[model samples]
Structures are given as C-alpha cells and as structure tokens.
Target chain A: MFHLIKKDLIIQKHLLLLYLIMLTIFIYFQNSSVFIIVLISAIMTLNSFYYDDFFNAHKLMNALPFTRKELVSAKFIGIIVFTSATMIVFMIVSSILNGGIVLLAWQWIVFSLALAMFYGALYIPLIYKLANQNLISIFLFIYVVTAILIPSILDYINEYFPNIILFFYHLPDSQLYSLLLLISVIFYLLSWRLSIKIYEEKEL
Target chain B: MSNILEVDGLRKVYAKSQFVLKDIDFSIPYGSIVGFIGENGAGKTTTMGAILGTLKKDRGAITIFGKKVDVTKPKIREDIGVVFDDMNFSSHLNVDQLAKVMKNIYQQWDNDKYNHYIQLFSLPKKQKIAGFSRGMSMKLSIAVALSHGAKLLILDEATAGLDPVARDDILEVFIDFVKDKDHAIFLSSHITSDIEKIADELIFIKNGEIILKVNKDELLHNYAIVQCRSDTFHEINEDDVLAYITKDEMLNVLVSNKHGLPRGCQISDFTIDDITLLLMKGENNERTHS
Candidate 1:
C-alpha cells in the first residue's frame, strides 16, 4: 500500500521544478493560500491519474499482486499524502518569499486537507466507475452547469438562506474546521469503499 | 502430470455480447510451457484475466499451486507473473524507476535478476520506456515478468511485436524459466512458431473453444496435412480427419494419424502454421461441411 501511494510521486517527479515555481508565484501573489493549496493538492493527485490512464497503468496495477481494495485505499490515502506534502512545500515557499519562517499557516493546511478529501471523495469513485473519457464529460457538464447557475443560485441563497449563510460564516474557525474535517473524513472513507467495490468488478 | 496451474470448465461472457468461453479447460504442468494459440477475440485475454482474477469468471474453477484460493489474493498472486500486451508501467517513469515500482509491488522481486535481464535485453536503464520500440517494450515486460520469482508466468502476446531475433531471445528466457521443474508458463499468442519454438504443449482455441491440445512433439511428428481428391476424401475414414479445406480439385485434409492415411496419400512437409491455419479455417470432422 505504501508503494502504491509512492507511485504517484515517482511518476510526477518530473513536474517538481514547475510545481516549485508555481508555488512561489502562488505564495507571492495569492492572498487565499488555502484555495491554492487545495487546488495544488487536487492537481497533484489528478496528474498521477492522467499518467496512469495515458499508459493504461491501471490495468497493470490491477494485474499486480495488490488487491482492488488496496488500490482504492492507496488512492484515498495518497490524497492525504499529497495534501500534506503540498502544505509543507507551500509553507516553505511562503517563508522563503517572506524572508522568514513566520508563514507557517497551519489553518491553511487543515482547510486544504478538508477540501482535498472532499474533492477526492467526489472524484475517485467517478474515476473508478466512469473512467477517463466519461469522467471528463461529467466534469465538463458540472463546470458548465456551475458556470451558468452561480449567479441565480447566489441570488436564491441570499434571498432565502441568509440566516444559514450567516450562521456558517460566523462559526468559529476551530469549530468550522472540525465540522468540515469530520464531514470530509466520513465522505472520503465512504468513497474509498465505493471505489473499491467498483474497481473489484471492473473488467481491467 | 503435476500441473502448476489448472482451469476446468472456465467460462466468461462479456456483457451484451454473444461471445463466450465454452467450457475451456487446460493445464500448464510444472517444467513445461503451454502455448495458447487463438485468433483475436477468441477469449485468450479473457481466459488469462480469469486466471489472474482481473476479470471475474461467469463460471469455473481456477486452481493454482494445487490450491483453490482466490487468485487476487496477494499470497496467491505472489506466485504468479503476468504480462498483458496493452498493460504497461507508467511511461513517465524510466526503466530504473520502474524497477523501484516493481520491487515494491512484488514481494519476491529480485533486483539483481531484473538488472541482469535489463542488461541481457540491452534495454537502457536511464531512458524512459516510452522511448522504447515495440520490441524493447516487450523485452522489458518479459524481463519484469521473469525477475519476479513467480512459479507460473501468464503472458498475453508477449512476443507479438518483436523481431525474430528479439522473439528468440525472449523465448530463451521463457525456456530458462521452466528449467527448475517447479515453474511453468502459460502464454497466449497467435504466433504459432513462437509456441512451436518453446512450448512443450500446445492448446489451440478458436471462437472461445479449445479445439485441440497435444504434445508439441506429437503435433510436429504425427499431425499431417495431406492433399486428397474428392473421391479419396470420401474414402478417408471420418474419424481420421481433424479438419479439411477444399481448394479447386484437391482437398487439404488435416489428419492426426498420418500412418494409416488413404493408400496413395502421403504426409506433406508442414509446419504448425499450416496446422493452425487449417484448424482455424477448415470445418471439424464430425460432419464435413464447408
């Protein structure tokens, strides 16, 4: 399982230089480092899947001695691993850019972990079930819908869900982080199990 | 014979497809290479997948190492090595990194053996496998399959795209694999000559059925394709004809027993390719129909 998790890093090692430069830019320019870390973590994990699909490596992985369950588990755990590594790098880059070690934002790391898990919870199962081609189409569909519905959805929420929005907005950072983390862990584990079931029956 | 791997009544049906493996059965005895020869879509990959537990079987039993355990289990699969034509390691990784990935994957992965095969196959360690030619890719696949201390190797078209020389070298590796008498190889290929070169036994499949399974030596020495005139064809005993094809005035008959062929008929100089062509194209002997 550790080997399976490490595979993502080994395959993506070539992109390390580019990723470091991007981290520098993000730390220098972006105020919302939380979002940057989350996005970076997602891209890191997605790149591995892209390489796997391009090489048809999933077939080789499933054919190897590892079980479908372990394959799925490695992926879920791999997301956390990538998130942690991304957070560490993001901190170091920010400190270097600021000329000190005063930029260690643990809150950003926690938020990225929560969101990365949530993103993986939604993404991994689709990847297992729908694969690359279909997953792309689904992602496109979601992007288009979100693009077209954002304004109207915001208007609706503002009109009717103002109290709910304000309540979440005013929630203390510690409690909110705890809530999001709890939700992310539950969904991530459930997604891991779902992916395992789908992968076990996959014809690869 | 003590077999390393055995499949009895193995069957698989693709969802929404008419093709099905019709009670396929065969075994690879220890110290032998069993070649599975079949046309494309003849369930060769499907059968290999079933044995490897990559594809679930609709019905059958696959017993390996004399145990009826799930092939997907790590311990069970640890004894097996598999190479699929389309399956490969990540192209982004070079050959050296691939060895690292494999070392972590296979419990019995031998680094020294892997480096030996890499050197033997003349594959560059620093170059990414994506730069490898088809032949080189195949050699690497075989090298990895061999480096793992697997008792049974299941290969699907592992020699398909290689040149004659490269194929010969890989075949030598396979022959060397089963020299221990505790090891066996079950490899599928449409290339009959590759099988003829190394396989101790040959199992032929057409349209998802095992048409024939025989010793390689017996197939070479006893099986013959004799040309027969229509009258001579009718005169030939029905039990003697394995398959037949009519071309103009002559009937090319595939007979398993050439010693008792019709009076004037003689065994022709033939190869496994000819036998495979006849078995694939000609009708069975039960009732001769074009």
Candidate 2:
C-alpha cells in the first residue's frame, strides 16, 4: 500500500510543486486561508486519480499483488498524508510571516484540517463509485447548487435556527476541536468502507 | 509434465454485446511457452483478463500454482507477471523513477536485472516513457515483467510493435526466463513465426472459442496441408479434416493426420503461419462439409 502511495506521489510531483507555490501565495495574502488550504489539499489528493485514469494505471494496479481493498485504503491514506503535510507547512509559514504562532493561525489550521478531512470523506467514495469522468460532473453539479443555495440557506438558519448557530459559535475551542475530530474520523472510516465495497465490484 | 497454470471451462459475456467466451480451456506446463493464437475480437484478451482475475468470469476455474486463484489475495499475484499490448505505466514517470516505484511494489524486484534489461533494450534511462516509441514502451513493460521473480508470465501481444531484431531479442529473453524448471510463459501474438520459434504448445482461438490446442511438435509432425481437387477433397473423411479453403478450382485442406491420404492428394510442408491463415480465414471442415 505504501508503494502505491509512493507511485501516486511520484507521478504528481510536478503538481505538488505547483501547489506549494499556490500555498505560499495563499499564506502570504492571508485571505481565505482555510478555503485555499482545502482547495489545495483536494487537488493534490485527487491528482493521483487523474494520473491513474490518464495512464490507465488502474488496470496495472488491479493486476498487481494488491487487493481492491488495499488500493482504496492507500488512496485514503495518501489523502491524509498529503493534507497533514500541507497543513503543517501552512502553519509554519503563517507563524513565520506573523513573527510567532497566534490564535488566528491555530484556528485556521484546525479549520483547514477539519475541512480537508470532510473533503476526503466526501470525495473518495464518490471517486470509487463514479470514477473519473462522472465524479467531475457530479462535483460541478454540486458546486452550482451550493453556490445558488448558500445565501438563502444562511438566511433561513439565521431566522429560525439562531439558537443552534449561537450554540456552535459559543462552543469552547477544545469542545469544537473534539467534535470535528470525532466527525472526521467517523466519516473517513465510513467512506473507506464504502470505497472498498464499490471498488471490489468495479470492472477495470 | 507439471502444469503451472490451468484454465478450465472459462466463460464471459460483456453487457449489451453478443460476444462471449464459451468454455475456454487450456494449460501452460512448467518450463514451456504456450502460444495463444487468435484473430481480432476472438476473446484472447478476454481470456487472459479472466485468468488474471481482472475480468469477472461468468463461469470457470483458474488454477495457478496448483491452487484455485483468489485474486483478492495479494500473495497469489506475487508469483505472476503480466504485460499487455497497451502500456499501463504513467507517462510522467521516467525509467529510473518507474524502477523505484516497482521496487517498492514487488517484493522480489531485481534492480540489477531491470538495469540489465534497460541496457539490453537500449532504452533511455532519463527520458519520460511518454516520449518512448511503441517498441520502447513494449520493451520497458517486458523488462518490468521479467525483473520481478514471477514464476509465470502472461503476455498479450508483447511483441506487437517491435522490429524483427528487437522482437528476436525479447523472444530470447522469454526463452531464457523459462529455462528454469519452475518457470513458464503464456503469450499471445499475431506473429506466428515468433510462436513457431519458441512455443512448445499452441492454442488457436476463433470467435471466442478454442478450436485447437496441440503440442507444437505434434502439430508440426501430425498435421498436413493437402492440395487436391474438390472431388478428391470430398472423398476424404471429414473427421480427419480440420479446415479448408477453396480457390481456383483447387481445395487446400488442413488435415490432422496425413497417413493413408487418398492417391494423388498432394501433401505439402506447412508453417505456423500457413496453419494460422487457414484456421482464421478458411471454413471449418464440419461447417463446409455439412
């Protein structure tokens, strides 16, 4: 599994360099750091699938000694490794730029990690089931719907669910972090299982 | 002789397609190369895929190394090396980088052997595989397949895009691989001459069915192509005839046994290419006679 991860990373080495440059700009600008981190993480992690599809490497992989379950596990593990490494890099750069670690930097790091976990949890299973082409279409569809719905949804929540929003807003940092970690772990595990099931039956 | 791979009653059907592999059966004995000969869309690749567990078989059993295959187990695949006609490695990776990736993937990957093949095939070490010509890519694939200490090699058209010199070199490598008593190769190719040169057994498939499987020596010694008039051809027993083609008022017939052929029936020497052409282009004796 680690070998498979290494192959994915090596294939996307150029993309990683591009992500590093983008990440530096995002850190220096300090605008939408969380979003940028999540975006970079998603692209770097998903780049493996792109290379696999482009080269038809999946057929070779399936023919190798690794099982479909192991292949899926390796993808999840690669995402986690990539997200964690990028988060660490961003945190260090942010601290360096600000002269020291601060509360805002810590908050952004935690939020980015949470978002990375959520994205991996959501996308991995989708990629496994729908594969490359269909997954991209579904992502586009969701992006459009989310863009059109966010404002109205926020208004509705602010009007009728004010207390719920307040409850989260006022939650202790430790409690919020714990909640995010718990949810992330649960979603990731479920996604791994779902991906394994989907890939086992998939025809190469 | 002990068999390294055995495929029995294999069957597959693609959704919304009429093509189906019907009860395919063949075996590759240890220390021998079994050649798979077939025309396009004749289920050669499908059969190979089924044996490798890449394609789901509707019904069949594939036994490798004396045990029923369980593709979900990584250990089972550790002993098999496969090369398809289409290159499967990432184009972004160079040969050296690919070696690194393969090193981690195969437990018995021999870096020395890989480098040797690289030198032997004259492939550029630093150039990305995307820039490689078809023959170069094919050589790289074969090199990777051989570097791993796989006891069985399954190759589909591994020599498709090579010059005669390069093809000869690769064929020699295959011969060297199976020199050990425990190693074997199952290869499919349109180049019947290559098969004729190295194969110990030959399997002919047509339209998703195995029409003939015979030892190479037996095939060469027992099978004869007889040229005669249509009247004399009709007199020959249909059971002894395999396939025939009629041209210019002469019938060229492929017969399994040449002994006691009718008088004036011209028995001629036949090559693997000749047999392949007849098997593919000519009508089966049963069909024609009926």
Candidate 3:
C-alpha cells in the first residue's frame, strides 16, 4: 500500500519542480497561504489522477498484484500524504524566502485537510465511474472549473449572502469545525468504499 | 503432466453487446507453451481478461497452481506475469524509473534480472518508454514480464505488431521461458505462424467459444485437409470430418485421422494457418481434441 502511494509520487517526479514553481508564484503574488495550500493539494491530487487517466494506470495497476481496494485506499491516503508533504514544503519555502518560519494558523492546516478530503472523496468515485463510461476528460474539466470558479462562487456567497455567513459566524466556532470535520471524515470513508465497489464491479 | 493454469466453463457476457464467452475451457501444462489462436473480436482478449481477472467471469472456476484463483489476490498474481498488447506501464517514465516502480509492487522483483533483460533487448536505460517504437515497446513489455520471477506467463498478442525479426526474437524468449518444468506460457495471438513456431499445444477460440485444443506436433502430423468429390466425401466417415467447406465440385474436408480417409480422397499439405482458416471458416464436427 505504501508502494501504491509512492507510485503517485514516482510518476510525478518530473513535475515536482514545476509544482514548486507554481507555489513560488503564488507566494510571490502574496496569495493567502490557505489558498496556496488548498490549491497545491488539489493540484497534486488531481495531477496524480490526470496521469492515471492518461496512461490508464488503473487498468495497469489492476493487472498487477495490487487490489482495487488498495488502489482506492492509496488515493485517499495519498491525498493526506501529499497534502501534509506540501504543507511541510510550504513551510520550508516560506522560511527560505523570508529568513524565518512564516506559518499559517493551525486552522488553515485543518481546513486544508478537510477541503482536500472533500475534493478527493468527491472525485475518486467519479473517476472510477467515468472510467467505465470513458468520460475521464470531464474530471480535469471539473477541476478547472473548481479551481477557477469555486473561489468566485465563495466570493459571491460572502458578498451577496451575508446572512448565511452571519449564521455560521454566530455559531460556536469549535462545534462548527468539529461538525465539519466529522462530516468530511464520514463522506471520505463513504467515498472510499463507493470507489472500491465501483472499481470491483468494473470490467477492466 | 501437471498443468500450471486450468480454466473451465469460463464465460463472460457483455450486457451492452451480444458477445459471450460460451463456457470456454483450456489449460497450459508445465514446461509447455499453449497458443490461443483466434481472429479479431473472437473473445481472445476477453477470455484472457477473464482469466487474469480483469474481466469478471459471469460463471466459471479458474484454477492456477492447483488453487482456485482470485486474480485480485497479490500472492497468486506474484507468480503470474502478464503482457497485453498495447497495454503496459506508464509511458511517462523512463526504463530505469519503470524498474523502480515494479520493484516496489512486486516482492520478488530482481534488479539484476531486469537489467539483464534490458541489456538483452538493447533497451536504453535512460530513455522513456513513450519514445519506444512498436517493436521496442513490445520487447520492453516482455522483458518486464520475464524479469519478475513469474512461473506462468499469460500474454495477449505480445508479438502482434512487430516485424518478422522482432517476432522471432520474442518467440525465442518464449521458447526459452518454458525450459524449466515449473514454467508455462499461455499466449493469445492471431498470428498462427508464431503459434506454429513455438507452441507445444494450440487452443482455438472463435466467437467466445473454444473450438479446438490439440498437441502442436499431432496437429501438424495427423490433421489433414482432403479435397474429395460428393461420392468420395460420402465414403469418408462423418466422424473423420472435423470441418468442411464446399468449393464448386470439391468438398474441402479437414480431418483429424488422415489415414482413415478413403482411397479416392486427395490429401493436401497444410499449415497451422490453413487448419485455423478451415476450422474458423468451416463447420466444426466436434470440439476435436482437448
């Protein structure tokens, strides 16, 4: 299972420098480190999925000794791995550029994890289902829309839907975050199980 | 002789299409190469997919290494190497990187052995697999299959698109693979000549059904195509006629027992290709011999 997780890193070894460069650009523009964290995690996660789709690596891996459950588990866990690793990289890069450890609040880290979990949970099963339909391109397309349109949608919500934001603000911060984390965990686990079922039923 | 792989009553039905694997059955004995021959869309790939567990068998029992196989299990798959036509490792990685990926997935991956095959095939270590030509890609795929300490190699059209020289070299590797009594090969290809060259046994599949399985040498020596007229054809035992095609005044008959034919029948020297064409194009009398 470690090997399967490492597989995503191995395939994307050549792209690491480019990903770092993108990170550096985001930092240069002084984008919120939270935005950079979520975006990088999404990119890293989607980058692996993109390569899998490009080479039909799921079929290749299935043909190998790896099981469908292992494959799906690796992707879900790999997101955590890559996201954590990126956070570490972000810290190192920030310190190298600023001559000190410039860290985001602990809340950003938790939010990044929750957001990435949500993204992976939603996409992994869709990727499996789309693999059957051979509509994998839509995955990247959706990624583009989410990357470009999601922030705008959030911005729109903040500007036009103040009462919704006020309702969340009035709620106990601890309880709201705890509830969000619980929902994300349940949804992530459910997606993992769904992906395995879809993959098992698939005729690769 | 003990068999390395045995597939019985294996069937796959595509709900979106009418194609069905009609209780297909065959086996690859240890120390021998079994060639699966069929035309395109004749369920060759589908049958292979089913055996390898890529395609789910609707109804069947597959035994590999004397145990019921769940190809999903990593332990059994560790002993079985697979090579599928136009399907392989990620094209993005170089040959050297590919070895690293395999080493992690397979417990018994041999670096020295992989290097040996790379050297044997003259594959560049630093070059990415995406740059490989059809022959080079095929050689690379075979090299990977052989390097992983596999006891049974199942290949689907492993040498389909290569030049004659490339095909011969690959065929030589296959012949050498089964040198150990513990090793076996079950390769599917439409190229009958390749089968004729290296196969110890042949299993022909048509429209998802296995039509014939015979010893290669026995097929060459005993199977005969006889051209006889209506009177002589009537005299030829119906049991002897494996398949027949009518051409004008002559009944081109393929028979398993060449000596059993009547005197008026004219015997023709035939190749495995001829037998395959006759069997595929003509009517099958029985499953012949398994």
- The TM-score obtained for chain B by all candidates, in the order given, is 0.95, 0.96, 0.96
Which CAPRI category fits model 2?
medium
Between which residue pairs do clashes occur in model 1? none
**Ranked candidates (DockQ, high to low):** 2, 1, 3
The DockQ value obtained for model 1 is 0.68
Q: For candidate 3, what is the lDDT?
A: 0.83
How do these models rank on TM-score, best leading? Answer: 3, 1, 2
The DockQ-based CAPRI class assigned to model 1 is medium
Compare the candidates by DockQ and give the number of the best one: 2
DockQ of each: 0.68, 0.69, 0.66
**What C-alpha lDDT do the candidate models reach, one value each?**
0.82, 0.84, 0.83
Per-residue CA lDDT of candidate 2, range B98-217, in tens?
A: 998999899999999999999999999999998999999999999999898899999999999999999999999999999987999999999999999999999988888888888898
Query: For model 2 chain B, where is the 10-residue window of minimal lDDT?
Result: B281-290
| Candidate 1 all-Cα RMSD | 3.0
Global Cα lDDT for candidate 1: 0.82
Error of 1 at B272 (Å): 0.5
Report residue A93 deviation for candidate 2 (angstroms). Answer: 2.7
TM-score of chain A of each: 0.86, 0.84, 0.86
Better of 1 and 3 by DockQ: 1
In candidate 1, stretches whose alpha carbon ends up further than 4 angstroms from where it belongs are A103-106, A133-160, B285-290
